[model samples]
Target: MTRIGVITFPGTLDDVDAARAVRLAGAEPASLWHKDADIHGVDAVVVPGGFSYGDYLRCGAIARFAPVMDEVIAAAGRGMPVLGICNGFQILTEAHLLPGALIRNDHQKFICREQRLRVESTTTAWTNLFDEGEEIVVPLKNGEGNFIASPDELDRLEGEGLVVFRYLDNPNGSARDIAGVRNQRGNVVGLMPHPEHAVEPGFGPDSPAGARQGVDGLRLFQSAISALVGA
Candidate 1:
C-alpha cells in the first residue's frame, strides 16, 4: 500500500484529520514524530495545520527547525511530494522550502469559514486531479493566513504558474488572492486552507443539494498517490 507520512509536532492539532484524509484517499498513513530525523520511507508527507509549538515565537517559527523538518526539506529537494496545510505552510516558508510569508489577516483576527478557491496550477503533484480554473470549497481557519512575497518573487511565481490556488472570496487579504502555491518542481505544495477537514462527504461542508459535498479535498491525496506510484 502507498503510505503517506503525517508529521506531528507538539501542539499539532490536525494530524489525525490529515491521517484520516490519507486513509479516505486509499493510502496508508504513517505517524512521523517531530523529533525524528527520518521520514520512515513513506511515499509522501503531510505537515498538517495546527498551532505547532503553541505558536510561540511565531506561528511556525519554532517548528521550522524540528528534526523532522530537516528530512522533509531534503526529501522535497529530491522531488518527493509534500503538502503543507495552514501552519504547516508557514513552516515550509520559514524553512525556505517555498517562497513567501504568511502574516496575520488584514483585520488581525482569526477567520473560519468554508472557503472557495480557484485552482490555478494543475501540474503540481498534489493538484493533478484538479482542472485548471476549477473551483473547490474547503475549510479555512486561521489568523496568519495572508500570504506575502516580494514583488519580484510574486512576478516570478505568476510567470512560472506556481500559484496553485486563488481565493474566490478573499477572506484573508492574501496577496493576489493566492491561497496556495507550489515549488518550481511542483512536488512541494503549501496552502492556507484545510483540505483534510473537507475530505469525508458526510462529515464535511454542506452542499446546495442538502448533502455534504466537501469531498473535493480527497483528490489532493489521490493526486499525490498517482504521482508517487504512477497509478
Candidate 2:
C-alpha cells in the first residue's frame, strides 16, 4: 500500500482527519511527529491543518522549524508529493516550499463554512482525480485564510497554470479567487480549505440531496494515492 505521512505538531487538530482520509482512499496513513526528522519511508507527506506551535509569531512561523520539516522539504525537492491544508499551507509558504503567503481574512474574523471552489487545474499530485473546471464544496475554517502575492507572481501562477483551485464565491479575498496552488513542478500543493474534513459522507457538509452526503474532498486523497501508485 502507498504510505502517506501526516505530521502532527503540538497544536495540530486535523492530523487524525487527514490520516483517516488517506486510509479511506486506500493508502496507509503514517503518523509522523513534528520533532522527528525522519519520514519512515512514506510515499508522500501531508501537513495537516491546525494551530501549530500555538500559532505564535504567525500561523506557521514557528512550525516551519520543526524537525520533520527538514525531511519534508528534502522529500518534496526529490519529487515526493506534498499537500498542505490551511495552517499547513501557511507552513509551506513560510518554509518557501510554495510561493505567496496567507494573511488575515479580509473580514478580519475567523470564518468557518462549507466553501465552494473550482478546480482550475489538475496538474498537481493532490488534484489529479478532479477534472478541470470542476466545482466542489468543502469545509474551510481559518482566521488567516486570505491569500496574497505580488502581481508578477500572480501572473506567473496563472501563466503556468499553477493555480490548482479557485474559490467560486471569493471567501477570503484571495487573488483571482485562488483557493489552492501548486508548485512549479506540481508535486507540492497548498490550499486553505480542509478537504480532509469533507471526506466522510455522513459527517461532511450537506449536499443538495439533503442527506449530508458530501465526499467531494475524498477525490483529492484518492488522487494522491493514485499518483503515487501509478494506477
| Per-residue lDDT over 74-136 for candidate 1, one digit per residue giving the tens place of the 0 to 100 score | 999999999999999999999988889999999999999988889999998999988898888
Best by lDDT: 1
Question: Model 2, 1-231: lDDT tens per residue?
Answer: 899999999999999999999999999999999999799999999999999999999999999999999999999999999999999999999999999999999999999999888899887889988889877889999999999999999999899998999988998788899898999988999999999988877778854445447788898899998888883
Clash pairs of candidate 1?
Answer: none
Model 2, poorest ten-residue lDDT window?
205-214
Query: Candidate 1, overall lDDT?
Result: 0.92
For candidate 2, the TM-score is 0.96
As for model 2, its CA RMSD to the true structure in angstroms is: 1.6
User: So what's the TM-score on candidate 1?
Assistant: 0.96
